[model samples]
Target: MVRSATTAEFRADLHAWLDVHEAELAPTYRGMGTLDEQIAQMQRVKAILYEADWMRYGWPERVGGLGGAAALRTELGASLAARDLMDPGHFSLVEVLAPTLIDFATPALAAEVVPSLLNGSEMWCQGFSEPETGSDLSSLRCRAVAEGDPSTATQWIINGQKVWTSLAHFSDRCVLLTRTGPPDSKHLGITAFFVDMDTPGITVRPIEMINGVREFAEVFFDDVVVSTDRILGSVNGGWAVAMSILPFERSSCFWQRIAYLYQRLQALTRLSEPTDRNAEIIGNAFLELHALRTRSRSTQHRLAAGATLGAETSIDKVLVAAGEHAVYNAARRLLHNTITLDDTVHGEQWRTEYLYSRSATIYGGTAEIQRNIIARRLLNLGDER
Candidate 1:
């Protein structure tokens, strides 16, 4: 499993491996169990893949990885999602936070922590959004001040709140952003930290989603003290850190999502009654899904080729939201009243997913925001304001 293998070979071998281990890897409950169960299933799958070295193939050798094309990791995730083994959105979070830590966190810190993350021994959350700042991250109010000599501060005290932090209550650590410069400095004032969740002054309150899943939380940091060693990059350089991770959040996370959308489309086609309208709707969904996949594949290739991802990735975010919406829309239309009225397992599954899809335009940055980034940065247009 550690040896060099093409993505194709990786996929084929993984499928065979999954075939042999399907009984153990499959979810114990039906129709997307409780958030706790989903988290457990994800961790269980990650631990197994890590033990087999499949999870480490695409990572750098310095961080307990086998060192190969990153696509190996994406392919592994896609295969898992296609088979309905896990929720692609949360599982793909590894692609978002892990690389940022590896790049910015001190070598000792990354070496000490990343393997546990990849192996599912720990969970981490991004702490950027605040009660007053959701997508307008530069306006965030969380503040962290060094507690000792400015040049060689040993500790920093953090105080403020973060909202809509996914998996916060369940996370073992947080990649936190804080205001470190003058209040008016905006993005340039921010600093990032790697804080332990059990640190004495932290509190978490879960927020249940419209679908009844308590997947996000509001976190309070009251006089939280963090070691200087936890600083994730240069002081007052967190905006860059935040920007660096967006590519992964917008692009890498969608690799598995694209697969999940395709899987849902397939399920919809099979479950719904066949008719001209059904065929047309399903076919249209497939078209959108294909567009998303094509764009995702290009983004993955760019990542593997060591390209610097930027505003171009906003397009991926746009496609992810649109593609997911199209698929679930078809599910709602084709399944007719089943999703709304039927109390069966499949009905609940479709209903929950359909509801979740409605948020596609909002999370991971909004569709309107993505369009603004596309227009301003990518197209050289003036700010919309």
Candidate 2:
């Protein structure tokens, strides 16, 4: 029976389920466990949520969803984070990449692929930033040339390199964007495709970041063949598809993450020593998180109301980055030596997260680029490039 519960009802029901499932969902491995273990744990939790139909809400019925208010999914993610069932940071890839597939992939493709992702039977990665194209993504150099028999067949042969591909080494497929036009084509002639990671001539090498964790990877594609049927949206029309992906990344994803950050801040407050400095830092972090949560609420409402987000959502991205940085900075200020010099398990987790927070300004879009967007597009200030 489909339980079309109200938000309050759903929350109560989910809480009850969690009370029983807590033991099963608890992380068996502590600090610095293998990435394989983390991923396996993520799948275990996802499978449970999917079977409960909590994972299906907010998604389309055509793609194995239950077809409810988007808030249902948001609440589900929040519950998972609050319960510490999964790492909010890593689980966010679904919120980032799934909507892109739903909006851009063919109906057949969405039906065939999205279930694998939602069920954790498969993992997907986004191929956006290259070495020289992090902030200026439109300037990517990955090339895709049209190929196959001219009469009845159509395809593209891709050859290029992508860097900073999050989870690429573990991904089963990638939502990739490649250049199909001249060097100066910019965003105009770019195309998007769903490419198999295990396809012939594709290589993925893990890139170790400052934290000594290889969470992201560099991917190389040489003569990677993709059928025209795999092309998302249209040949030169990928810019729109890419642009449409931003709202979910910025807003819906931001809300659940904010909830997780709040939980962490509260935990930090509990762990802090008795000092005025610690109190001030905790207060500041809390305020920043509060502002972010408020802003995020409106964005989530907009999304659920079916409004298309644009340059304005960049504000949400900025708030998220700032709030995340602030929270981690508070940890550093309060925990002090533990995060820096200590080699304990908890210290390592805090240290890793702090270093990862440095990239908060860089990922999704840089803090600089986001500010520029707010100035030009939202405030109607001077033009920025």
Candidate 3:
């Protein structure tokens, strides 16, 4: 299927549509809103866009989308972020998870669930990190045992725990990882599953962050019975599935975040009184953000051209974390005591964002881990010990 509009044309038309519908799309809460408010506002905006056909532009028609290059959806999201209609990180999750389903799930299953995600009827979470394993993904112990013969089993019973799963408590489904192989099998013996979160014997408890938001969760699966049909990719090929998601998460998903940061930077400028030191700091932050956007733009184009992204996106991961920290650090520097002391809604938002921004180096993948990937995979400088 072909997209009817050019990228620039789509951008112009989307902006015009948004201009006309500003009142309808505006959020009811102040500043960026709490996590609950953000989710509600995001879903409300998503449903409106889906209804108006704006949300369907980049996704395949088989998934209830109007087919086009995936980059078009990035444009949609960047625009929303620029205008403050939707949270960029929340909006970009489709790029991270939906494509995984399309590429790995049975066509019938992908067709059934992907539409629900795009239309704001369903939310999904990734279940990869564990309390014991952390970023050492191959050490995952969330076991899934076949109910009968391994080769022909129709049911698998899953039992284990997932920690730091973002929004698991609110998610309708999960793209989960399980240890299908032996305990010592490591990376070679995992599998991915598209499991319904409402299934019996599953529990979710949200984890409150330093920023006072319960954005992450601890999820437990106890003898949860899932059909063989729910496997995302081939058995023991979940390592491949895991690799496929990181590229999207680090690169494509970060584009709209760049837009969000740009907007926040502009807001920071408005709040700060101009000083010589402030000028230098904001200028440096702008340069770093520009670098991130330029690099991420190339990644989005590569995805548009159907290029396979691999360890190279670790560069994107590094830049996004760096850029995020730079922006908020600049905020703390320029705004000073306001960010640290104010208890007002507006001031609290800045303080919370500043706190959250500090964790950029830890989530998705750590800075040290990314630098190791860059050294080992991209630069070819390091030897494995």
Candidate 4:
């Protein structure tokens, strides 16, 4: 077995490597472009990191990685985010989905597919939320029924719709959730599947965001037949698979986002003149970012220590949304007319980010929903419903 490098050692070695490879890894694009371009750029960066073995660290050996502490992966994301080589949100999708695959996917299946995602050879999307079921994921209506007798079925037929599926249009695969029981079954009846995008009867339609980027999409399944082997977990146990993904989404994924926010904050300071009001605004944003980072650091450590994270991670989600809004709000305010009028790269960037920040509270579980979870599950205050 390979001995894992400590966080400090990993940081030193990674920083040294980044310095040597900075020129090669630097993004060629200047400001926000189409989602396709951004994703392609992300793949380019991941390929380089994978070739150098930086992307393989912290993942299990069975999944085509050089086994090491998970913190190495977190640190790698931070490094990439700080340098603006990858979009933190898109870059972190792997962190959000891959672990669930490793935990629930068959050993053979995981080994066969996970390395593609890790090395950026393919992209996958999370098909969790439907048009009527964003926060109330248990109420998802997408249906997946076994084609033959349950005992001897070789394939499952899926039919339904999923909206707000991030990057679904560009994704090669999806970790989809579907109702397998009676409509009233809710959480208990849902099942998860790893479906290929090329599967017949699957349709992907892009949705343009206010930022002028097609960052999300609506996916429809009409008699899409999938091998039973694609089941992520036991039938009717998708809630567990989803539950495992949420903690990572709320915690591990936020590390890179926090790093990116800090980088944006620094840029905002550089753009603003040193005024009392500007100082106050920047200071408050910094504090929020700091709080988020502090909370997220704890969550990361817990995950690294192999703890099963639960509702407590709701706090991390809340802080991340708050910090994101604060940072971009500051940019909108401090940049003044430039943000509102100028058409330069910097101005457009600020405008785009400001608009995108509005959705921070909406994605990764809404702020209202997260607060409810904190109150009911973490604080034992009351029932969410």
In candidate 4, what are the lDDT values of residues 118-154, reduced to their tens digit? 8889999999999999988899999998988865799
Backbone clashes in each candidate structure, one number apiece? 0, 0, 0, 0
Tens digit per residue, CA lDDT, model 3, 50-148: 999999997899989898877778888889998989778777777789989999999999999999999898889999999988779999999999998
- Runs in model 1 with CA error above 4 Å? none
lDDT for every model? 0.89, 0.85, 0.89, 0.90
Report the Cα lDDT for residue 11, model 2: 78
Better of 2 and 4 by TM-score: 4
Q: What is the C-alpha RMSD of each candidate to the true structure, in Å?
A: 1.3, 1.7, 1.5, 1.6
Flag regions of model 3 displaced more than 4 Å.
1-3
TM-score list, all predictions: 0.97, 0.96, 0.97, 0.97
**TM-score pick, better of 2 and 3:** 3
TM-score of 4: 0.97
- The TM-score of predicted model 1 comes to 0.97
Model 3 backbone overlap count:
0
Span of 10 residues, lowest total lDDT, candidate 1: 1-10
Clashing pairs in 4: none
